[model samples]
Target chain A: MSHEPRDNPAQHREQREPEELHTPIGWPLLVVFLGIIAWGAFYYFHDLLSATGATSEAGDRRSVVVVDPTAKADGAAVYAGNCAACHQATGMGLPGAFPPLAGSEWVLASKDIPIQILLHGMSGPITVKGSLYAGVMPAFAQLEDAEIAAVLTHVRKSWGNAAAEITADDIASGRKAFADKSTPWSEAELKDKVGAP
Target chain B: MSLSIAFLLAMTFLISVGGLALLVWALANDQFGMGQQAAETIFAPGEVGEVEDPATPSAARAVMQNARKAAHQASDSEELFERTIADQSSRMPVLFWLSSSMVWLLLGSVFGVIASIKLHLPDWLVQEAVLTFGRIRPAHLNVVAYGWASMAGVGVGLWLIPRLFKTALVGGHYAIAGGLIWNAGLIFGTAAILAGLSDGLEWLEFPWQTDIALVIGGALAAVPLILTLIKKRVGHLYVSAWYLIAALVWFPMLFVTANIPNLFVGVDQAMLNWWFAHNVLGLWMTPLGLAAAYYFIPKIIGKPIRSYGLSLIGFWALALFYSQVGLHHLIGGPVPTWAVTISIVHSVMMVIPVIAVAVNHHMTMLGSFRLMLYSPTLRFVVLGAMMYTFASVQGSMEALRSVNTITHFTHYTVAHAHMGLYGFLSFVLFGSVYFILPRLLDWEWPHAWAISLHFWLVFVGWGIYFWPLTLGGWLQGLAMLDPARSFMESVS
Candidate 1:
């Protein structure tokens, strides 16, 4: 610690000059910071304008899109990057090793089961885009609430399937039910639950 | 526009030009002469005191005075430095504390709110010139980055550099003038934006009229610093000074280069515009803020940096690498390949400095974990430095061709920006403000609850805000790469 500079213990001791408070405040810094605040207000309004620029896409279209939240690119990316690697991009997964997404009725036919299947992925024989594919689809329960919702949405939207959106809130509800990712889903486990559609 | 309105607008532009002239004049004079000596001579008046004492006119006296003047100048150069420790006992505690932290905390909080809400509800409010996300986002950023952080950073820098170097502020006049211009510009610029007249670029959103006044204010602010350095007693030239000086140089360049509107005639605006804006975050603000953390943390705790050479490499590399960091952003854009290639290369090079600075900061805090138990400054700064490391790694990753494939222009970049600026730079500055407030004000902060409240609101708000963006960005990035996807399909 030879290069170490020693602190004077006396320096740490307190003093009481309630009067030296007028140590010339900096004008330039104030201007810079304040300038930024004003600058931000400009964008607040500008962003408002940019938002309005696309009036058609704001409200109604969003609802239709949200209905298939997996349609969310972020959500879908998670699905494709992680899930699709095995689910065989088509969802008509490999007969035994992976499941096919193409025309799988399970994805289109149900809402509640998909959430369950997504949260605690199916390992035993399960139905996907259609035919009974017996493969272990890893549980994504450990994924972030948003990720879980997104993957479920992607599967629902892709491969000629149709279903309601899987929102973040729905995933949160599933999280409350199962916090860990170890459990695998059976068809019976998802046989009765109903998603908000 | 009416003649009167036109006149007012013209006057604003005039003010900008006028300030730039003053800045250039000061800079030019500095090149030819040791102009900074004027402030030091004012305070010490060493030889001038005795030389002028014999008021009688005599050549012999004048020659004798010259010899003494040279000696005094030589001696003054070898300073017995003091860390400009404020008689921390000063009582104007409220004004000092409030000006530095309270003002910015409030400003930052407001912008934080808007930033979060704007994400989900881009069209939640009126779609006027004054209320667009584009205008408001930059305005919010400038306020947080400039309005709040810069004020507080300079306030702390004003006090701390002197202390660390064992010196005091030399010119109150310059400091005071700078303060006025800075505040007036901020108020006017913020108001103008609220009124819906913004230039509509990131950080450079402040229209030319107000920006000019702020630059004038900045030069005035810098005077005391130039004066203090000349008066500095230490030869050690601590690492913090390096960080600060880099910031001072970088900010003006960012503003001058970015604000040169004629350069952005029509089509090539975005390419040039983003270059300036992104670099400001990379070079100007972050360096100053991080430099403060490096100086204060160990200065207070009583330790040497884990590696001095590493600190040097980090600082110099940051200066070099940061200048070309924005190009990775436009990797897939129509900007020339060379531009994108250099930026991406520097962005990757950015990793070296980031790690070096982080190691210097975080490792120094390793044994001083006990300080975090009692010192709020250490806690905030440590957190900020940690964030600096986090965000930087993410930046390099995003710069990579492969990784950018998944993160570019998505919520991921948004999150990274926040993590770097707000998470690292802003967080550290907040701590610096809190620490300096007590030292300058003489009394301890009256409202710890308020302080805690401020920190929590910012922390939680930021987490809630940035996390979603990263997740969403990743998905968006994936969708963009899918060739089958159209614009509507990608966002959808």
Candidate 2:
């Protein structure tokens, strides 16, 4: 029996049973586990605390319930949702990439000029506050007249711009005035239609 | 829906509390006192410190021979019985499961490549409704996930259990029948998906009727494994056996629990979808891969695992952490803040298991790294093990709110999914198959170089496949985030 080889398949003891080295779970793992737990508990409670303070129980009903078209649009909310991405929430847009809406001559020119610019998007080079900006601003034609007017009113009131508030009636008239315009307007094209301020 | 979230949250909380209680009990009772003695459980009488693999030197083999012969003085009849059990268990069922799984793998890969190609060239296969990207994509996913990956897992798992128990498979016929039914169900389900009769959920594209087949088939397959465990000749179960047995139970439970008809609706349905989808990877595929790695890595290299305690930590932490991670898939979705937050934390907590497993495997393989050069199984399994660490840690990071916000809808997610499922799980399965097939069939792999070629091709191919998509997807996410970039620009 002592002479028999351990490699034969027919033998029940052909292979050794798998063993384990006597390594201990050292302090590093303990530290990591405790650290993660502490962080998780902190994060969880922090989220709950901040969420409670910041949000009402109503809690983002924008998606859950249907909006009433007759309800007055919140100008600031509209601006935050649509325009704030490009034109900063501060209304001071990205330098070179986007033009600032804060105290812009184009925005404060005539109410008609800003309304037309928004209804039909701008392309090619356009100057805002003496800086030349070349980019595309997508048309907000899909927006309701009230939403368009509300966002425009928001920009006008914000960022030290003392322009008068634009009404939904102004947006409606602007849409009708440029109903045939399918393509975006260039800076030259906009100047040709409504003279520069 | 809130009820569902509350239920899941409570369940996670209960598991954490229960785990903590168990830890306290262990500490109080000194359960972890005998770390060295616990590590010795895997060794039989004279097997301790014995190198029993083919790579062992002739002098070492002689020493092993003397030790084993002295320790295990079995009679001639006992040896015959052992041989008989080994030969009998490696019969019809394993072959059927493995061969069919290979066939499905080939088919699934073809479908996947076609779907991928169509993403760039939409008009390429648009003529056939079945070949359109929408139909083909889900078809590919379902086929690979259920038909190929699951079947391979069952085959290898079934084969390993009998060996671990030192007994013949208790109900081999049931596994065969189950394999047939499972294949039939997969075929019907895939055809139905191509014919536009899908359920329209990501992993649940197979209709309810087909899901019934899957549940029944899975139950049938599990019978033999459970019975084998019950009828075992071995006194103590190994860590690998634990993983395999747990998987057999976990998969069936997950499949049945998630597949109950009309069980969830609207937001709850989305939650359930991700829960099941993620757990399929976590509980089902992951256990099988880890079990294979735990067994083969030590067996091939002629070494014990690094630490028995770490293995226990890895297993328990995985159970407690992984189950909660499903909700991380809904991180930025319409789910409750607390629920997603818990999931994110759990996802991060997964680092515990990943690190534990990593240390054990790495330390075990420390001196035997050169074995990968000669053993195809070692190469594939080791790479898979390493990727498990990589994929898991990456997944943990990806679950963070800050990271998920960018990568959620992008191809980055797709790349990450493949790293885990394909690079980790599939590679492990491939290695297991390489090792198991030769033993089961009583024949060596005809071409070792061919196996090496296959490895390199996949290794290189996966690198080519993964990096671009990950980088491109990250850039895509960035572009989508930037207000200056157009929608079409991001698409391009």
Runs in model 2 lying further than 4 Å from the true structure = A1-14, A56-197, B1-21, B24-44, B48-84
Per-model CA lDDT versus the true structure: 0.61, 0.79
Q: What is the lDDT of residue B239 in candidate 2?
A: 76
Model 2 lDDT tens row, B208-317: 89988888888888999888889887765677887888888888888887888899998899888888899899888999999999988887666678877677778887
DockQ of each: 0.02, 0.17
Best by the TM-score measure? 2
Highest lDDT, which number? 2
Give the TM-scores of the predictions, in the order they appear. Answer: 0.58, 0.74
Scanning candidate 1 chain B in windows of ten residues, the lowest lDDT window is B47-56
Task: Tell me the docking grade of candidate 1.
Answer: incorrect
